[model samples]
Target: MDAISLCEQYAAEHGMQQKNGNAPWRLFFRKEIFSPWHDAREDPIGTDLIYQQVLHGIKSGEYKCDKEEELASLIAQLYYVEEGPLEVNHLENQIYKYLPIFELKKNKLANEYWTGSIMYQYRRQFGVNPPDVHHVKESVVSFAKCRWPLLFSRLGKPSRNTCTIQTVSGDEYYIKSFNSQKIEYLILAFLNGLKQRSRFVIARKNQCGDDSNDLLDFEVGDLLELINGVCGKELLTETLVRGENTKTCLQGFIQSENVYVLPALIKPNANVMIYADNRNDFNRSQEATAYPQWRFGRDVLDMPLLKKLEGRKEQCNDAMTMFMFIMKYMGDHPSRRNRLSTDITDVIFKPAIAHEILRDELYCQLLRQITMNPSVTSEEKGWELIWLATGLLAPSPYLLKEVVQFLNSHQHPIAFDCLNRLKKLNKGCSRKFPPHFVEIEAIQNRTMQILHRVYFPDETNEAIEVESSTKARDLVCQIAKRLRLRNKDGFSLFVKVREKVLAIPETEYFFDFIRNLSDWAQNINVENSMLQINYQVFFMRKLWIDVKPGDDTNADLIFHYYQYLPALKPISRRTFGEEAENGNLPSHIKNLHMIRKPLTKYFQCEIAK
Candidate 1:
């Protein structure tokens, strides 16, 4: 409502009080002004789109924001809020993400100034919804994927012997030089105070004709080949490098005055990288989305969800399946349309599942359901299905328009109600989808979530769907199915707790590994979240005594050769006699500290103390 109407409405409701016997002010007219803050309201997605459009317009000269006054006015109109308009101190980089990427790349100083300007102008007008670590990780992954498509082409696979990862950003190119670190890993490590580096062959020497067919970067391709040859099927550790005297282990590789590929004379730092002091290193890092941290209010979104969320007789997962129960036409009500507007947090998607819904194009599946199931159904029922998919949770801004347009084209009743309700925030101010989920107390078949876990035998890890009731035997079966192993027998699901490899009982619940891990974390002075796992649920040949590891299957052969062979130690007269056979092995054979003697020697030496 305009201010005059608002004032008049107030005056009519509560009679206006006279001050100093003055005349009634009827001449005062209200002037309406648009506020970006008011429009920003609770919708970050809408605000993000608006800012993106405005920046794009400015870049295209559609918005004449060249002059200081015009730009100032535009900034004020577009971003001014009570926090920014008249404030001295403030935060930055929240709104600059909306700036044109190309324009933002003009200069470092300009980027900083503009980022600050936009920050001062806007400053989260609606709320303080900041991004979390998970959001940051997602952003990093997206940026990396968008930045270098081919570099990640061989992700979760071998780099092999000949390939140099290629990338292009204008004229400056990037090529993965070494397997010392993945690009994303290094960025995350450094950001988290674990400094690590990765070598990338930026450019090639001697111009080539066919760019696609040829190696555009340095001889990092050859280095990858060398590393692969020496490592073989095993993890390349310092022991491997030292043990194999014939292998030319890589210490460092770089190209400057002359290309230097040095052999390992001195041990290299675990997370160190060969630094090439390029002038554009800073810009290149920024381009990779390495430095700047991005934030969002919430990861999951909620808009128009359940028709009868609040109307549920019981607030449990079983209650959630009322729609299915009503499939035989048990409950019928015309008030479903009105009830759909009321949102309650009783219903939610687990975060991983929510990401899957978007990532795996589950939304498309929902649409496909509508088309496939053309059985005689009412418009209200059909709309219910449509509302569950599109309006169930607020989609990303990129998706919202398409969903709206499609529904409008089809003349679906849901289009206007859904769209209008969101922008207006009619029913509730909190339209955000709840991120965490309700852990089912009853664990009903309808509500139970299939917990997926990764089990590793060798270099490759296999995914297995688990549940609270899923036993170790069930997990083994799933692994066998996934790995296509005919001989699943005699193999144990070994939960490696730090230094210990414990075989999980066949009857024990698969989810109990989490409890075991928690216990292990508590045993040490480490936080559960911060504990770096030594190994995961390891699948290997563990139970069969007198059984040859290679005799059972190809997987057993891998476990035998790589895992067992190196760990196998022998006893001899010189190394160890029957007297000392029962004693623990020395920490190192060359150790001269405390003597690990026979049981008799311990009693003899203790009297001297």
Candidate 2:
């Protein structure tokens, strides 16, 4: 007998004949690359050989490939070049000559519809569209695209195709749509109580079904239908019709039967079961317990409801069962809950729960839960409850006074968080106690001290001359100080002045124009203040910074003379005021505001007389 015949005999003995391991199957090819002709003597029939040959050819530049096209050519040529179509036919004849496996184990010969990994790989290589769950039907069998359903089902065989669950109420839902690996990943990350349910289903290395295009949206109307089915214990033996006009029983169709499966998005109540078979197989509820003995943990033991039970020494199985039911529901059906706010407030924030859980224990658990839940935003109501509760437990202020005092200190990061919240809470509201708010005042004083130290920490006398760097430093300090007092009357006054100028049609640029000039003034050297004005005039004139009536424009010279002059002073405030015994002081002491020329006519007009 030929090698093909011998190989077929071996395959038959090894039980390599089946569609989903049912129909007889045979591996075929258009050609084959002989091992003897290549440097590496590897079995060409094996998947590894096929992969290695394609990869090696591409990497070695033999294929001259770009993306999908090149890969496809290489795969087809590598697998078929040697045997050729005629030789492959001859080999098939020889193989079947000795191999008489049952057709049930030889599904490849049944129809072209039965595709395997080899065909899939070729399609991918050739830029052919890969099949998705949507392409699958009752007659078509395939592996699942989602991992979650697989894990939850835990059957040893691969899934046939995506499942469309039909609710008794005539609603339809499609689970495991295309590229359902993400759904599996999420389920795995947060495995709850359905571990046992996994044993009853098929387990495949592939995901359970496609999730990419799967859409899940339903309403109460759909859920009621499902609940009625479960409550009535209807053993659906026919394909259930769903959507606008589906009407069949759940178990009527056999495996591999040609039909569409529909699933409902609406969550049935706990009393309802989702039927995978005659008895409705319900999904483990999200509200069900995620872990065994879950109530014993810090998350629950410290919860207010638990604390209330603890106070009464009430040890009943009913409470535990109820808690587990809720936990499971939350895990399995997150969308069903109206809101988690009530749950957090009543179950988590109760005073008794607080008393039971140690600060560290509570914090670590909250942190872990939040970190794992990608959807939990800081501003989310649930998250806020968690944040405040956690703060009170671990980072809780040591004393009521510490609440405001620590915020004033800014000695730690927590102080920043506190200040942010405090600012928001007291935004436009007037303070009931000003002088007593020593913490707020202390924080302000601390900021000012830092600025003073940065500018002229050691200068006791006011005769110190201002330097460019010192003036710049003071400007930043002053700006920061103003920002801190954003809630104060001074800031209000600044806003009013700005608004007044902006309100005018032509003078709208007056306040903003001065603010821009202030930036340049800060950069100039004190000794060259007058020269800076000259440059300013030349620059503005070049840019055509002209003002027309109703244009809200101001004279550059005037704005600079008023805004920049007052700002350009000795680093020391006293340099502008103090005088020597001879009545001589800083040369730059004269304010530029004294200049008489319109700001618009700096270089064009005569100097102030």
Candidate 3:
């Protein structure tokens, strides 16, 4: 029989009904039984196992009890259906909410597994939602994919066994399904445990020594003792203090019944050590370490505290100590020495400390420190040294000599840049360059030559001579004559520029024609410049009529024609007789007139004959 018929038979025997007075098995059969069964058929073992479990439960009289018992029996039958043998130890109490088994031994085994196995910790960490269980399973699968590729590869295959025996290097390691399942449970537990440990440590570190409310408690910026993980003890300045009521710690606060103290000190733990007391000093040290060649100028080093602690030896010791440390660091490298020289001009060589630190001995020592470094200098390092030398408070003769010597020895782009700047400074200000910088001047000259060559080509030097006196009327006449000869029929001539055509007006004067041509050329190129012209001819049909002998004597019988001719058109003529009177007609048309004269002579000769 079909799944629905079998479900209805079972429901009738078990007295099941729906709220609408229909059979409950009608809906349940479609959704729960038939759908699951159809989907499970895709796997070869699923359908057979489910059918065998359902039949076994019915034959064993497990579903012969009340409604709850029947439901539980059915669920348990479905839950235990799988490819491998059901391990009672692996099924914990979490699964029993759906598969309500009444067997005492199975229930007790599930309780033991829940309390003792890592599944209990997993549930405590992430809750017992179905999605949480899926998350744990996914995490396990991902871990296995990364750590053990061979084992994970067998998981989804239908024919693969859950348990396997393998020999590796003359040894046998037992691989079982239970081990993989157990590991899936333990990963979440370990992560949750580590999270709790970190919270506890942070809590203990923030507790104050005094319990009295009147005492001035420690705030951010208070100096305190920090226990370093590698080093023993170090002093640290607090940068931030987070309260217990803050959102990040709110859960812990509520869980502890709000007994956790307020205003927890948030300091960098054992990983970082802060040696300086003030922010400026700390920042300076950090910057010096990160970019060792960066120079902080007088504007930066002119702190208010420097003036207050000028003569006080004890109070200024920290500043002096940091300076000495920076100096020592700078001395260790050539680039650092360059930066140090610039920095000292701002901090130590100021007017206040001029006598103390910027003496003749110190000046010589600094010059030696800058020039004595044997490291091969690159272009960038050469520029840095030049910057160091240029920023000195009073340009000493020895210092300038040493800078010029360095520039001479290191001839590069950077040296050239420095030389150009120095030359400009000498012209604009009191600074002067030594006589040994002839190579720098030569480099500048050569650079100018290259730039001139690159920007100016030979063809651009020759001027294009355009005749400015060419009249526009002459050009228009030339264009019209050319168009008339090319197109012998009645046609109009136009000058085509881009999409538009310029038609020659019949009464246009010479100046107007010149202006229009100039406007056209200006639109094409620039004003009053010569423009290339393109001409167009539009042809029209002509109907010529001969004049009779009694026509007016002033008429010359030459008629211009149009494309659209009227049915009865009047014949009128404009004068071409002026060309005949002046004998200006071309030789070919004049020869035709000469032939007419000869024909009249022939007629006279015939009459005589």
Clashes (N, CA, C under 3 Å) per candidate: 4, 86, 0
- Across residues 167-234, which tens digit of lDDT does each residue of candidate 1 receive? 22224433444542454444333332211111211221222223444222333212222232332112
Worst 10 residues of 2 by lDDT: 534-543
Candidate 2 — number of clashing residue pairs?
86
List TM-scores for all candidates, in order: 0.22, 0.23, 0.16
Tens-place lDDT per residue, model 3, 380-478, is 333343443332223335445654665554434556555444444333222111111112233324331111110001112111111111122333344
Clashing pairs in 1: 131-295, 131-296, 301-433, 302-433
Off by over 4 Å in 1: 1-457, 519-535, 546-551, 567-609
Q: Judged by TM-score, which candidate is best?
A: 2
Q: What does candidate 2's lDDT look like per residue over 1-609, in tens digits?
A: 376677666776888745553334356341132211121223324434444433343345433423443333333333333323323335344332212233215576632221232244444443344333222211011111121123213232234335454554346765554434433443343332232111111111111122353222222112212222231112122212122101221221111111112222233233333332233323222232344232222133323233334443333233333333333322411334453323323343233233432232333333333332312121132233332432223332332243355345333333455445444433322111111111222232432111222111111112222111122323333433433322111111111121132111221222123333433553555664323121110011111233232222232332223343334344335654555444665444464333434432442232231
By TM-score, is 1 or 3 better?
A: 1
Candidate 3 Cα outliers beyond 4 Å, as residue runs:
1-136, 139-238, 243-609
Q: Model 3's lDDT to the true fold?
A: 0.33
TM-score, prediction 2: 0.23
Model 2 CA lDDT for position 55: 37
lDDT leaderboard ranking: 1, 3, 2
Note the Cα lDDT for every prediction shown: 0.38, 0.30, 0.33
Pairs that collide in candidate 3 are: none
